[model samples]
Target: MPTTKKESLQFGLMMCFGMVLFMTIYNLFLSGFIEAITLMEVIKEFIIGFLIALTLDIFLVGPGVKKIVSKLPIDKSKKINMVLAMSTLMVLAMALFMSVFGLAISYLHNGNEDNSLLKDYFSTFLKNFIVAYPLQLIVMGPLVRYLFIKFVLKIKCNCNEY
Candidate 1:
């Protein structure tokens, strides 16, 4: 249990926001929100995307990319590599999540093959990925990480050492 009311509140808010964000993205491309998005579609897309992103992040970027980045001198290049690495990882994660989830939703909602809504949704997903990923990394990732870290540190400092 969270000791601080603020922590509990923030956790709840993050969850709510995340779900809303996910649903909004799904509707904008896949379903258009004329009807409720199905749970199966949501779960499929989220799981597939998350798995793809996690796998890519761990296997592709985690070791090889870091080693290459680590070789750079501690200067602007290093900073650039750090930013690049983080951004790339985040984008991949987001892409994977959006793709699987979007596909599932679009497939579920679309009635006719001629509609091609799923394909269009995929394209939109990629387009949105290109635009939104940088923003998420630059804004959401740093902000949330910093907040959580600071919150944890504050809690730790407040603890009575045995």
Candidate 2:
């Protein structure tokens, strides 16, 4: 079993990885197709909210979850599975966090209220959130974790023997 500190570190890394990957994917597709949110606008919004959600998940959410999970009677061999599960929870948690953060940021940046892209593309906004958030939870979180543990982690271990 990894130490608490190690697990915490791993979880933080995974959380950040998930957040950035999800944001990049969402921004790319939304900007390319939706036209409501431009590349620059996506970058700005992502910059403002991404770090906030990442920090929240890493410092606040991840550690709290670690404490809880530590108390569970699960086997140590299940660490990878546990990390994947926790990452999914973290994504869901951050989705709500980012949505609220996005709303607040939109209000602050473009106080024109009705003239913002959000107002112009309300349906697009809703679609993006509904689709992206769940997709992250379903695919990015667990699948990425699995790939990391299976492929990337294996490569790293093998390469370290050189």
Candidate 3:
């Protein structure tokens, strides 16, 4: 429930970071431990994942979250409530949009053309949604918002007076 473009951008940035971090952990847990021979590869994955996530966040999730929030019966005056609602909605939106994209990424990474993404897609989606919803709702959302509110949004630095 961002009322301004700046807030929307800030929210998107937060999600972008959260997604990149989450995806890195997911990717590592899936296959990186055995496959990665060096830390450089992990760093590369992180950078590439960050770029991909930022693009997806700004292009897909950010606007979609705003649209979904707009449809919900939310109280704009209640910041905490709005944050919770938006975080929940964002998790749903991410699950809906990013799951397939994640499948594609996995497909590319694994070089598995024989196995269809359709197979076990539901199970994968459910697992991802279940894991991500709690992480987003309980950890990343509040942490990011708290940091933004405490240090970024509420701070104003003015110098060199007239």
Candidate 4:
């Protein structure tokens, strides 16, 4: 989808921002902060999460997903196939890595006294993947693509162009 380096960066930033914002809220709710969540708190968590997620996405997940998608037997000529494969893999990888980051932060702050680090990590990963997969595939992916094309690329529709 992104043909240029600048477009790639833009796309990544947009995706990371949306994903981090939603996921942070979802995670806070999961942790029973439903009524207690503050805007400033969400902003703080989103900032930290966004930085880490963007770094992981650019350096690791993006390249690794591309590599994995390339090796898949799906038809490369079909843009839909490529897009689906890439999105699925990217979501999977990001969810996996971010889950670990989340657990580390939780442990650092709360201190894992139950010795259930492994269990908690897996549970977190599963819960994150469940929500993240659909959130990306159904919502964020299409939304980001449309925004990038409309705003970043400045592509006008024929119906609206005078």
Candidate 5:
């Protein structure tokens, strides 16, 4: 959806902000930490998570998704087709990488005494993918696009231009 580099950066930042916020809260709730999580703790975790996610999304996942989607067999002329392909791959890649980041954070915060790192990583990846796929497609993707058009593009209605 972003035509220029500046627009791409803005779009990526907005997407990362919402996705990180939602995923952090969702993961904490899933891990049963929501009951004990303080606002300050949430804020701290969010800041860290947002930075990591934004970095990965911008430097790694964004370019990779574009490359992969360009190679896909879908009809590129159809904007929806290209959008869906890119979104799907982007979500998949981000969820995979971010799950590892999440697991590392969990290990650092709680310590993995059970020595089940591989198993835990798989579980975390699956859980993250399950939520992230739909959240990106159904919510964040559209919402960010709408916000970008409204604010970044500043596309005012013609009736108000008079």
Candidate 6:
């Protein structure tokens, strides 16, 4: 979604905010939030997740997807179609990386390490990706992109014009 470092940073910040919110709620839900999740816990998760999301998206996945997606035989003449395609790719890439970040945060929070770290982490990644993909594509992705386009970048795309 971002072609430059400055845009990437802004995009990353938006994504980090959205994703951390989603993951915090999802993780707590899985752990049975009925047991009471604390404000401090949420804060910690947000901090760690934000850092991970920002770093991974900006440096690794964001640029990689840009190059790869640009080569795809998509109907790029239409901005809406291009945006949708990019959003899908971004979600998938972000989910993949979320596995590593989730595992680390879980370990840090609980201070409990699994013997089968690799296996467990892979499983965690897969589960997270499944849920995150849809949430990003349908909700957070568009919202963040819109905000970026309007407020941050302030560039109105001509995609909707014939």
Let me know the TM-score candidate 2 reaches against the reference structure. 0.58
lDDT scores of the candidates, listed in order? 0.55, 0.60, 0.69, 0.86, 0.89, 0.76
Could you give me the TM-score of model 1 versus the true structure? 0.51
Ten-residue stretch with the least lDDT total in model 5: 152-161
User: Candidate 4: worst 10 consecutive residues by lDDT?
Assistant: 153-162
What TM-score, computed on C-alpha atoms, does each candidate reach? 0.51, 0.58, 0.76, 0.89, 0.91, 0.77
**CA error at residue 34 for candidate 3, angstroms:** 5.7
- TM-score of model number 3: 0.76
Better by TM-score, candidate 5 or 2:
5
* Tens digits of lDDT, candidate 3, 1-162: 345777767867776787667866775676545365457866776677677667767787767776877777878788777777777776777676666666665665666667665774665577678888888878787788777766556552222232
Question: Residues 16-118, candidate 6, lDDT per residue (tens digit)?
Answer: 7987788877876765552566788778777877887787777888778888879999888998777777777877777777777777766765655545887
Of candidates 6 and 4, the better by TM-score: 4
Candidate 1: where are CA atoms >4 Å away?
Answer: 1-31, 34-80, 115-124, 160-162
Model 4: per-residue Cα lDDT over 1-162, one tens digit each: 888777888999999999998998888778666466577866877899999999988899998998889899999999899989998898888888899877875676567879787899999899999999999989999999999888877753444676
In the predicted model 5, the residue pairs found to clash are none
Rank list by lDDT: 5, 4, 6, 3, 2, 1
Off by over 4 Å in 2: 1-34, 72-88, 109-133
Cα lDDT for residue 10, candidate 1: 56
User: What TM-score quantifies how close candidate 4 is to the native fold?
Assistant: 0.89
Each prediction's Cα RMSD? 7.4, 5.7, 3.2, 3.2, 2.7, 4.7
